[model samples]
Target: MDNLPDEILLTIFDYLPPRILWSIISKVCRRWKNVVSHRVITMWDYNKVLKTHKGVVAIFGIRHQTSRQSPRGLAINFHTLNIRELVLCDNFPLGEMFMKSVHSIKTLRHLDVFTLQNLHTGYLPPPEVNSIVLNNNIQPGYLLNLARRKELKALHMYGRSQYYAVNEMSTMIVIQAKHLTHLTLRCPEISDPRWLVFSQCINLLQLQLYACWSVTANGVAHVLQLPKLQVLHITGSRMVRITALMELIPTLSRSIVELNLSASSFSSQHIALLAATLPDLRKMEVWRCDLTAADVLQLASGLTKLEDLDTDVELNSVDLMYLSEHPALKELRCLYEGEIINDELQAQSHIHVRSALTAPFPLRACGEGPSAGVLLHAHAYKPIDGVTLTI
Candidate 1:
């Protein structure tokens, strides 16, 4: 039924993102299914392949499996698994057991798991019983060893605050993964960064810090050592103590070029200090945080590299005119802070600035991580800033 050469079709299919290809193929007739499932098929797309597993299919997509206990559980072919990307998601009873089984896949280069929180260093399987282990905080040394392996490239973990001891427990586990280029932590209510992990990963280029425990002045200072890092994300920081930022901002302002301090506050000194020090910053985001128009004036006044700015405050035509003409201004974001932010009496300052930060990115080449799209979307703004809030 096909007139085209096999090689041509294979090449076109190979370029498709595995996740998308799998979605279409899985719905076709049975003969096609058998061919597509073959282990030697060279292009095993496990991106969304996790969804196709019988374990996931049984729960009907709503719940990931706690374990592969059922006789109907689909067997995963290690040869077919592209170990470079693995997702170990748990939805039920034996989650830890399932993750432990995945740990055995030796060729694994990237492993992403969403598991319960723990107090020990490295990744921990379900809670263990024993006062002796708990009292001494004895961790299975294997996890730290896992962290040190030379091959692992990315690691992501999220857990409940009740199970974590903050930084005291995680520091060694993190530094051990010396080759990791991407790291994400979603634990909330952390009090310190001592166990914060990731010190020797000299190659680390991207980091996502969401609802992670707060950094003390010392913790903030420690972040300055991450010289190779390029992108930063700080969310859910209302609980963040101001003292920690006061200590941390001076060190961070100069080093990071892309800063995302959304939903947090910075003092007058921090705003002013960062404004002058961060000469290299290319993009910035400030959302739902309390910073007066004056504070905004102080922080953003000197940032020539800033291309996009987002905040939850009001601004008027005068305020718009000043920012619209400012030397560094390109895109402005407002979050309808009950009333617009810029005032009439003080808006004329930017009438002559005319900042030219936004440039053209073809978007033909995609970014390396998840938030890459957001960065591209941020560029689609101008200082005659737009405001929208989700209800």
Candidate 2:
């Protein structure tokens, strides 16, 4: 081991986990310490290491801290490390200082700044950044400036402020509408004519709106005009009027593949319309919607290409038996509290059944959009344990 060159040693160290590399390998020798210091290292909530041709990129989750004190010596110097993506979650103490230092990095492309409470004043992404996900209480003026950047391709902003700046947000959407392919907004104050601006986003593929109560059927009519939309997720919105959904389904039926309407009021008729119009639908999530067991069965029978289904409707043994025989359905996630007697059926079934008291899907803080490699490393799905099935 001592005879190996620095290049070979660096390559070998890249495969080791962040904990081992930082604690053990870096202490072996002066040369090892020097090489390890130059590698990608940052504070994260969990230990995730991604190995690339250049070197190892370590993603560490930031632990929640009660005090305002920042972690000593943990501030990232972007000029030294070649970080391609950075995510700052809620309760991060050094968010402002850290964001200020990010301007030095030349390789950064994706930046996600999410804060539920703490507001990082004067926070802004550098000019090179193209994809941004913000869930902070930032000023609308800052967002207006961000939208004017011609290189911006993806923008996701969650509503956390008491006042919604409709004019500024509308202008932002209009400026970048032509270039953005992925856009998500959670504001509840946006409605009607403002939604008309979205029609200009000709290249949009994925659109998610959360808790936007003011956006009625009329507003959605405009969004359906996008030519390339494929994934549409509208949760907790009062846009479930039957007539509107039925009329809008056909416009996106041929192109849409994934649909999530969680926490919305969707009836049997809506499900029928979706199944009939959307032939290519593969993933559907309707948790918290009112649907009978028969409606679910009818949906599974109609959508031959459906592979993933998430719902809150309780499925009896017979329903489980029917789903077990489904040729295309591979996974079913049920968010039910009561006991389900399907032990025997589950043992003999090929479909994976998971039931939890609560929903497992959380609002992702980072690792989505164009960077496939980073998304895989940051947001890999972990299955949650379900309640014990009896009989």
Candidate 3:
């Protein structure tokens, strides 16, 4: 083992998992320490460790572990890892300092930051994570700085957060992140039209906004102009005006693939217009709406690509029969109380709420968004050759 070339040894170390890298390699002596400490090797997380006696022996070799505190209560467990995607939960002490140091992890491609409380004051932070999750009281300004990292791809910042920014950072940086793909912001402020930050993110694909009370129709209209947005999810408790979106949506035309609305008032007229214009829409979900199954049928006939409808509306046997008239729709999440008019639509669709996975699907309940990986929903759908079939 000692005779092996340094490059070869380093290359081999690259394959080991993050837990193994620190727990296993620390026992290999100072040589492996020097090799492993090289930031490049430790930047991204890895797994699948070697099974050698030497490899097993190396983990216990470290002399001292990292100290527990620094400004921002920063702890660099170099022995720890920077997993590619992150979803932070639970409360952390010294949240400011933690966030500050978290910014320096160049390999952090995805992140979810939350929980902000009063700090000791005057806390300076570092640039680290890429994708972000802002859920706590952390001021918008700190988030702006955190957003500076160029590699960020997805961001979900919730409302009711701390407004700690004395100076507004450039929201423009968000648009500049050339790789950003998905974003969800649920801000409840009734007067902050922050969508002006969307000018540069021309590559954005999926967007979801909830409780954006400050968003005027004009701002949303501009978002429709973003060119690449495929899915839109809007939900809020406040009274938001849709007049601007209504006017702007016609011009901001695209082959939108998906749309999710929770408690939206867009009427039958609105749905009719959307069906006529959005020729590429494959899926649309509504939590509560004024449109009926008959209106849906009319809209579906024109929507050549419409494949799924997730509605809270009930379906009667007659309604189900009417629903069968549209060939474009393959699925419907119908929530009806009357007689069952179940048809082919119910047979082809995979309709399960983010929460319902626990009830009927038999799928494992898990986290949301990026961390929402698949769990066994039904035993019958277990992996066959290599793929799992949906039941």
lDDT of 2 by residue, 1-391 (tens): 8899888987887566444655567778898887876664545432222222234343323444332444322344334556655555555544555666677767666676555553433667888878776655666577677776646777765435324477877888888887888877764677778878888888888877656567777787787657798887766555657667667766663688888776666778777777777877898877666688898898888898999887767777778888888888888876444556457876878888777334433324211211111222222311111000000
The clash count for each model shown is 13, 7, 24
Model 2: residues >4 Å from true position, as ranges? Answer: 1-60, 66-76, 91-97, 115-121, 159-164, 335-343, 361-391
Per-residue lDDT of model 3, residues 214-314, tens digit only: 56665655566667888766544224345644564476538468876545556566765776668788987655456676766666666767787765555
The lDDT leader among the candidates is 2
Model 2: weakest 10-residue lDDT segment is 382-391
Per-candidate RMSD, Å: 12.4, 9.4, 11.8
Q: Which residue runs does candidate 3 get wrong by more than 4 Å?
A: 1-78, 92-106, 116-128, 147-151, 162-180, 190-193, 236-246, 321-331, 338-391
| Better-scoring candidate (TM-score), 2 or 3 | 2
Name model 1 segments beyond 4 Å from true. Answer: 1-73, 77-79, 88-108, 115-145, 148-151, 159-162, 165-168, 174-177, 186-201, 210-215, 233-248, 253-255, 262-265, 297-301, 316-333, 337-391
lDDT of 2: 0.63
* CA lDDT scores, all candidates in order: 0.44, 0.63, 0.47
What digit string (tens of lDDT, one per residue) describes model 1 on residues 262-297? 656555557766776677777776654567766666
Candidate achieving the largest TM-score: 2
| TM-score, prediction 1 | 0.53
Worst 10 residues of 3 by lDDT: 382-391
